[model samples]
Target: MLNSEFIATVEGDKVPRKYFDGRGMYIYVQPSGAKYWRLKYRYEGLEKTYAMGVYPRVSLEIAREKTEEAKQLLIQGIDPNEYKKNQGFEIVAREWFENKKDGWKSRHAQVVIDSLEKDVFPYLGARNLSAIRPPELLTIIRRIEKRGASRVAEKVLQRIRAIFRYGIQTGRAKNNPASELTGVIKTQKVQHRKALPIEELPAFIQDVKNYEGMTSTRNAILLMLLTFVRTDELRSATWDEINLEEKVWHIQGDRTKMERPHIVPLSHQAISLLKELPSYPSKGYLFEGRKAGHSISDKTMIHALYRMGYKNKATIHGFRGVASTVLNESRLYSVDVIERQLAHIDGNATRRAYNHAQYLPERETMMQWWADYLDEAQGINQVGIVGRLKGLFSR
Candidate 1:
């Protein structure tokens, strides 16, 4: 007899071994340490087994009850396994989800599943796959669009289409209803991040300096202005990525939006600002959060912007736009250099491969110049040497 304690204490070895729970039910332990409860019964004189969930989750009492239920089904000339295999929708959707979820990153996979659960599953999850048609899918999609989430509606359509395609491959469905949704729905206009006008930079910079907030938050904003990197890129930055002596911040490909490793040449101001930042016990994140072992919240910068009266006028991401616009307008750097610095995709694989040192010298010069220009804009330096010299000569 298998009790809860025995079930819990069973150790798995290299070879799989089965311990009988009596009445043809046994717990099979695999070398990987997975325990599965199964019923070994002869159906029409042929031996077969029915999977009765995994251990702990199924528990001893539940497994026994399931075994008893299977015995009753056997008495009536029915197979529980076959009956379960015939079940549709939820089972098949999960089958497809489990098959493909591993390919997506955890966060992306969770979003996909959440979309399905909230939008797709409730409407069509329990329905037989083969029975679903284009009209039914369109109705669901239109309902989503009615709620003003055209993008979400489109994404749901794609997920449903993929699920149906998976169903078709597995003989669970014959046609994809979601395939017919193309051009049936409207797409929302792409909204770029709102940036303060270049003329507003002086006022914005001054306001940021005067803004009464956490010292860390003020430094974060200043760092964003100097670096022009993405909010998350800076938020999740670790101390190892920064070389104070070398004056370079190396961002690995995994952390970048373009999925390519980037080298950011730090300006003198940036290096000084970093040196002045208060160090925490954690040698990990440069910008440590309130909690240990975690970086600052994603909303930290946004909340700062809101507090500074820039809500709806500018966004944390808008700093990238400011850099792109100001750099392009200056015409002091090549488009290639600016775009590469911005980490934009150029579709030139060959150039990207061979040009790891592309414009490093130019970028170092440009970054320093940009920092000096920002200082001048904020009146950190009164006037250029040339202007002062011209004034003296004129007198």
Candidate 2:
């Protein structure tokens, strides 16, 4: 509704004043002689102002056009001011990342940034945060799935949802489009670590003994099988945690996945293996890596298994599964005793708190039985390994 003559004729005042152009549009004249085209409107009973442009640079006709466009947006129930404030996906996503990265581990934070840069930013980075619809995000995730990286796609989807949630909470976006994508991507099947079947244990044990890898890696594998502890726990084991006289290996809660302390009863075989391990007086690890003061890398064990021709057939972690299956099949121990030795969670909360040492006595017997079972399986005739004990056949 603004005219060029009236806009040009509008004089500066002592204070900023609006020269009405009719219907929520005006030319704001400042005391310093600067004029700006602005629109005033009510949205949800709250008054909001949107700046169209500056002075004659934005001619009366151009200002009128912008005002009409804003009116059309208002008619559609959109708040023009909010629409203008909503930033692009990349901008808002980086903001969200900055706010959240502090709480994440350094490696985890790096992975998230890499995922966003590689998978998300290239396609939809410049698009408005609120303007991107659900189907569009589905296309992005499906691109990752097409490469057979279903797990990466799932993680990318999670990151996208988190970014969208941040945008919504900050009032930059009205709704979460990613939420509409629930159940859209097919869940990837989880692949458990490969372990040998019980019947194949004897042959596998022979292959391990015949392996030509480093003695440290070999010891790691044997100790892992003997203790049935997690691979990382074995890799990071310190000498102080093991008491050769007590025949016990005590792992603290922080190192465990369940964040609970675990005690492993060492059999004579395990004790002999520990004694055979070469010592570094300066280092604390039971299995020290080639690098000074560091434990063995996970890849060392993995590649050792591959070189032993058990690449897909078995894993170091599979030893736990092998032990669990064989122990349960033997029926010489109770489920709680086996599970306690395995360091698995107890379902009952009250029991879990008090049951830290629940089956320690039975576990001692069960661990010795398991070690003897492994000795016989490997054709080793070590003394005390085959020594008979109390209630060998009782339920």
Q: For every candidate structure, what is the RMSD over all alpha carbons to the true structure, in angstroms?
A: 14.5, 12.0
Best by TM-score: 1
Clashing residue pairs in all predictions, respectively, total: 0, 0
Residue-wise lDDT of candidate 1 within 1-395, one digit each (tens)? 98889889888998999999899999999988899999999888899999887887678998998799789888889887775464456678788889988976453466578788888778877665755678888988889999887767877787888888888888667677788778887867777989977667777888898989877788888988998998878987777788888999998775676667888999999999888877532457778778876668889989988998999999989998988877776778898888878878767898767765568888888888888878877873334533542343454
lDDT of 2: 0.82
Off by over 4 Å in 1: 1-38, 41-50, 53-189, 280-282, 347-357, 380-395
Cα distance off (Å), candidate 2, residue 222: 5.0
| TM-score of each predicted structure versus truth | 0.54, 0.51
Clashing residue pairs in candidate 2 are none
* Cα-based lDDT for every prediction: 0.80, 0.82
